[model samples]
Target: MASQAESETGRPRYVPLCSSLLPLSRLTLIVHGPEHGHRIISPVEGCRRLYIRVNGIVQGVGFRPFVYRIAVRTGLAGFVRNLGDAGVEIEVEGPAGDVKSFLSALRDEAPPLAEIAELRVEERPPTGEKEFRILASRDGGEGGGTIPPDIATCDRCLADIDDPKSRYCGYWATSCTDCGPRFTVIGALP
Candidate 1:
């Protein structure tokens, strides 16, 4: 990156692209081709972790499974679990672009039952993990929110309940694609 203040002062300053910042005088700038208008390679690629803590009605709503699906699809390796506080924790490691895509999907394509109130992310050094998994839940810091008295019946479930031809219509206790009290939004989708 070029420094605005340094450029204004006189000679422009440049930020190191990789590492081992060599003096500007010793480094040579080369333009391979004008047509190559995109990044040919990632500045950094390797095991890197992003710690994400999601706060909301994330428990019992297929949130962890949802996270697993996206992580695999995004070609990432990490683990996800629910906290005792009705929150979710995830650690993803992979190419920065893929990790970024996973984050976007986490926000944009959550299960119908999930209501994300907050998503906190932190950066950590790589652990060189090779697989993505869903771990068991554990107690979280301090007191946390209580599980809802009951997860609200979702729209799809309501429809199923209302449909005369639908098998779940009469069954007061139902577990369908969208209602598990919280559904198992399968591995591929919600």
Candidate 2:
């Protein structure tokens, strides 16, 4: 029998993968890839995954950029998108600790005007994704779904707007995935 270390180093070496058996359950799989011009299979290929929904005043308010920042910071791989009904959806894959931290930050450090009334989370098996992204908003029934009220601009974005060289300089609409405006638009108001 191969010892843990040797077994791990060999082809198809095992690494802990996430699963639904438990909150942070680990699984193993055969990873087919290359090492020094040869194919290698990693035994430990399972990793944890999460699908989270943040509801209430989350759309149109820089939520995607905010989530992107967090994902990059936490070294997570997943995607986030806006929902027509004024909600946000996120899917992440990474170590259990990082995933949990990302969720916590989603609640505590969201954009200033982002009022997250409720956050729902579910864990699943990792899908072997390489990076995170922001997906287009989902279609909501008819009439272009109900867009939420445009949110008040955020401070970070505002500061960026003031920077002369900033790409968004002087731009009235500056958002960072955390806050901005949504829906609540009809005709010009001015």
Candidate 3:
């Protein structure tokens, strides 16, 4: 008889009864309970794919390059692209741990100019992608992302400006993905 692995909802889910249980990652057992809540246990093993759509001031803020850098660093495969609604779409597939890491980095290390109003992630089957890539922009539903406003000079840019040897020294318009006028420079929505 299979033992029970209960979820947060107290639903009885079945699992092999073993004296020594497998690590949480290996257990396909109960991760969450109830459709209303998350799994109570279990972390899906093997390759996992996540389709992430980030909304807000994501366009014209160097958000795509930031996503690309994190995706590559985490050893994930997939693509990141800009949406017509001033949002970003990222699809990443790799080991579950790596994918999770990518997600965390994406949230915690977003560009300074990007004010993420909403981030939605959905799990999907692997697509067997060879490498991470940046795809072209796509049209999206109406009225989602916010128009990015001009950002103040960040510490990094300030440091560069203060550096006597730097090329951007004393250059007032100096800006990168992180800080500077964004919405002001845009001719139109991307």
Predicted model with the maximum lDDT: 3
lDDT of 2 by residue, 35-62 (tens): 4344332432335688897777565556
**Model 1 over residues 72-185: C-alpha lDDT tens digits?**
999887799887767888999876777889999999999876789888999987565678999988875434553423455667777878899997887777654345543233
Location of the lowest summed lDDT over 10 successive residues in candidate 1:
15-24
The most accurate candidate by TM-score is 3
Query: On a 0 to 100 scale, what is the lDDT of residue 132 in model 3?
Result: 84
Better of 1 and 3 by TM-score: 3
Segments in model 3 whose C-alpha atoms lie over 4 Å from true places: 1-45, 162-164
Error of 2 at 42 (Å): 10
After superposition on all C-alphas, the RMSD of every candidate to the true structure, in Å, is 10.5, 9.1, 9.4
Ten contiguous residues minimizing lDDT sum, candidate 3: 16-25
CA deviation > 4 Å runs, candidate 2: 1-46, 141-190
- Cα lDDT computed for each candidate against the true fold: 0.68, 0.66, 0.75
Name the regions of candidate 1 deviating beyond 4 angstroms.
1-47, 146-170, 180-190
Q: For candidate 3, write residues 34-66 as lDDT tens digits.
A: 552644332433568889988888887888889
